[model samples]
Target chain A: MTARIATITSGKGGVGKTTATANLGVALASAGFRVVCIDGDIGLRNLDVVMGLENRIVYDLVDIIEGRCKLRQALIKDKRLSDLYLIPAAQTRDKTAVSPQDMIRVVKDLKPDFDWVLIDSPAGIERGFRNAVAPADLVLIVTNPEVSAVRDADRIIGLVEAEEKGPPKLIVNRVKPEMVKRGDMLSTGDILDVLAIELIGVVPEDEIVTVATNQGSPAALDPRSRAGKAFREIARRMNGEDVPFESLESKDGFFGRISRMVRPGGA
Target chain B: MNSGLAVKGVGESLLIHVPAGPWDEVLASLLQTVVDGGEFFHGAKLGLQLEDRELGAADLGRLRDQLAERGVNLWAVLATAQGTRSAAADLGLALDMGRPSQRAMQPDEPIETELPGDAAVLVRRTLRSGHHVHFAGHVVVLGDVNPGAEIIAGGDVIVWGRLRGVVHAGAGGDQDSVVCALDLAPTQLRIAGQIAVSPERRGAAQPEMARLRDGQLVAEKWIDEHRR
Candidate 1:
């Protein structure tokens, strides 16, 4: 099956781009689809670590591009999933080491083997970001529910359109359901109003996500995780399945109700 | 007398270098030259290039105020003089052209053909954030101009959709040039020399026309009867 190259980018840093990439890759692969995740951040590599495939990496994206290793050799197989793989970025190299055309070529080579290739773009609208999106058939802009993150998402969406890699989809990550209910945080509607792009998924803020990430395991591996369920739904949607968005009220459950009753106006 | 002043179009704006001489007399002559030009050089972005003249903060600030009072925008101050450059930098005027000029010749005749003019190109898609449209003639966009996108045209511009980006019309030297749109609320609008921003719309949007009026940029509703 030909791979659909999807790049996840956020203009601002530490907004869960690498986390989303790892989770989405795992979620897609677990559904019996062949998936590969590429860490586009050159000098600062994190996708490999996030996916927990750091130690297995013998060759990397730069090696593949530089002809030092075969593309298959660069593909580090995940310990948990046979179909899931990662082409880690070299920590010593900078963004200029790999060009946009090199990325396009690498993705083209993987297109024949994998069903989906998710690229984790570096923060800022610079060379690394361009390289990440160069081969993307679809772009997913990740943003938090804050004003600055939303604004950066808007900017990234614009750049995506400029490069003709649009129209990009948006994933609003780290959304606190209680805050949204209290009207303290920007809701899905508020984000869609400003961005004007198609909404792909809204990953709610879950403590499990933090714990799972710390353990170098994506939240998607846990079936009981709320964020994991959201990611699975996103993967299905990406595969052309029409999955309805999870209702926020149902997400909170009884524990959420108790907290809301006690705090009343807590964010 | 403002006899020694030599003005020329550098990029999209006029450049007037303040030659090393008596400050008081040169300033007077420069102001007189601007006044003599009537509406020709009014509301222009003038870059004063000082090669070696030292200027203090108060001197630069006073000059900026004086230029602003006369409808001129002091956008840049090019100086080889350390003190002058520092003063200008403190005032936040650009020291150099960060990017090369994207300039071309203006169209002499209106292009009514379907092929469009050689200077400008018509865009039929929405200009989202980060999209930039640069043309040598008038730009006619049939879609929305979102924030962060920019349009630079050498002639008048017409948008059949919402305009919110930074647009500079009449990039050549036609002062009577205008910009029209279905909803003409730009982040910033430039016509020949004058620059202005769209006032916040009270309610619904209507077809509007923007032009220089009394040396100031103004926007008015476009009526079908006033096609002429």
Candidate 2:
């Protein structure tokens, strides 16, 4: 099967790029597609821990690229999902250890074997970001519903377009519905207006995501998690399924009542 | 021998004029010249002037990588070929020197009747954050200018869509130059030596024009005479 490579990148740190990569890998694998998630963060490798495959890693991305190990030796299969696998980044090596050409070469080898290859890009539009994006067929830009994050996202989008890898899709993560209802947070509409990109998924703020991360398990494995459902919907959309976006607005909350009174028409 | 190649310093960067020739020979000679220059070429930012020499993205990317390995940074590409310009732009290289030392037209200089019009550059796409446009003449953008983007012009500046970025018109001290946009809310606006920040927008946005008035910068509603 020819794999479709998608890179998950966020220009700012701590905005859920690794989380999105892990969860999407699980969601896609569980849907019966063979998937491999590569952590492109090199020195700050965390996709392994997030995917609960830290203990099973024998070799890493750098090992494979440097010809120290075979590609099969570096792929750590996920314990929860039969078809999910991960190529963790080298903890001791920096981003300079791997070049953009190395990433493209490695991805070319993996394309013929897997159905999907998800790369977890590092923050900033530097070497690591370029390494991740060089091999991507699609780019998923992750950002929070804040001014700084959106600003960085816009910069990343510009860089992606400059590379001619556009138009990358956007995923607004950790959105607080209540804050949006109170007019305190930037809505999806506001972000789309500025960035002017297609919206892929809107993962609302969920406490279960934090809990799952702490346990070294992705929230997508939990069927009851709201973020998990959102990720599944995103996976379906990726596969060309026409799933309607789930409403994040709470219909019965206090802020919702105030908003309803203020607008009269359903928001 | 560095024949058919000229290197000169422009601001902080080195401007290299590459003569038109076979691609491989031109590239080899270019690299050889850099090698011969030794320490002077190392760690220098280069702006290549390729006159009518077409290049694709792969060729440009390879050249950049090769230069990078030799401790040189390729920051800009000045080319007459449309293909080379687009390729360089796709790689995020500056299309122009950005703030040329000489103005396109000096205010006190006598105008020539042979000249058809004032020199200007027209941009047809949205200018996202981190994108910068600097021209010695008038500037016109057919799309929105997002925040963090910047435009500096020697004369009037006009944006058909929203203008939310930093902009400076009349950079050569032409106070008569004006900046107008459909939505004239800029992060910061400057005309000649004066500067102004947009105030909190009230109500819906409307077309506005800003210019220097009595040595102060002010913005007013822009109304078309025919429509009015």
Candidate 3:
């Protein structure tokens, strides 16, 4: 099957682009799709660590691009999932080592074998970001529910538009539902109003995400994890599944307590 | 492809040798094309070489207004038409067959004018985050100025959309300059050398104008009476 290259980018740093890419890669692979996750953040690679495949990486993206290693050798198969693979970025080389056209050719070569090619874009509107988005059939802009993150997302979206890769879908991550209810944080609606883009997913704030990240096992592996489930739903949506957005606003302690108290049984 | 009607740069002004053609259509199309490319002709000094179309005051005045709407000034009209020359003189615009005098060209020179002032450039696109516009005159944007975007104007700024970006009106130390937008909330606003953070919007946003008042910046609902 032909692969759909999806690039996940955020202009601001530390907003969970790597985590999202790792989780989405795991989710899609578990669903019986051949997925390849590429860390587009040259000199600052982290997707290999996030996916727990850093030790297995004998060759990297730069090696393959430079003809030092075969494409097959550069790809490290996932320990947990056989179908999932990662072409880790070269930590020694900087963003200048790879160009936009190089990324296009690389992704095009991978298109024949994989079902989905997910690229984790480096933070910033520089050469690295352009390289990540150069071959994207779809672009997912991830942001937190803060004003700063949303503002940076807006800027990235504008640049994406200028590149004619417009109207990219948005995934609002690390949303604190209680804070939103208390009017202390921007709600999903408030963020969407300002950005004016299609919503693909909204992953609520969960402590499991932090624990999973530290363990190098993305939260998408755990069935009990809410954020993991949200990411799986995003993956499904990407695969052309019509999953309604989970009602994240009411699932916090406030509404959970009310629902449990009102309907004691299965209701 | 009309080789006779040469349009080229002469100093700062564009010298257009208007060849014999349908003057109305050619002039209108020329203006439309220039305006379509936003800010291409803003505040530009323009001269026309009208061979012998003895145009009246009404025709010249209409053309002048058209240029004015696009932020271009028709400074001179070189014409063999005596009526056209007279009309240019009536409008206080220059009229001659050859070059502009030193006095006429002085205002157009960057070295002569220490600062470009008052004349604003209007932009009709969203200034997304990280986009920047640095102009020696005023800046007027017809779209949203998202965060991370910046505008440094020598005079004033006006935006028709949300203004959440950094805007420095009167950037060259003209403290009397103001910034007005549909939403007057900016990440930071600077008039001359003073900087101010927009206070939280208590109520719904109305069309607001921000200016330095009483040594502190103030934003009030835009009213026509207070526009001056």
Best by DockQ: 2
In model 3, where do residues sit more than 4 Å from their true spots?
A251-267, B1-120, B172-177, B192-195, B212-216, B223-228
DockQ of each: 0.30, 0.54, 0.51
The C-alpha RMSD in Å for every predicted model, in order, reads 15.5, 15.3, 11.4
* lDDT digits (tens) for residues B1-228 of candidate 2: 445578877656788998877999989989888878889989997889997889999999999999888888887889989999888878878776653223333577565444235678999999988999999889999999999899999999999999999999999999899999999999999999999999999999889999887898888887653368
**B78, model 1: CA deviation in Å?**
38
Better of 2 and 3 by lDDT: 2
What is the per-residue lDDT of model 3 for residues A31-120, given as tens digits with 9 covering 90 to 100?
999999999999999999999888898999999899998899999999999999999999999999999999999999999999999999
Q: What is the TM-score of chain B alone in each candidate?
A: 0.47, 0.49, 0.49
Chain A TM-scores, per candidate, are 0.93, 0.93, 0.93
Clashing pairs in 2: none
Better structure of 1 and 3 per DockQ = 3
Displacement of residue B90 (Cα, Å) in model 2 is 53
Instruction: Report the C-alpha lDDT of model 1 over A189-226, residue by residue, as the tens digit.
Output: 76765677777788889988889888889999999999
What TM-score, computed on C-alpha atoms, does each candidate reach?
A: 0.64, 0.74, 0.71
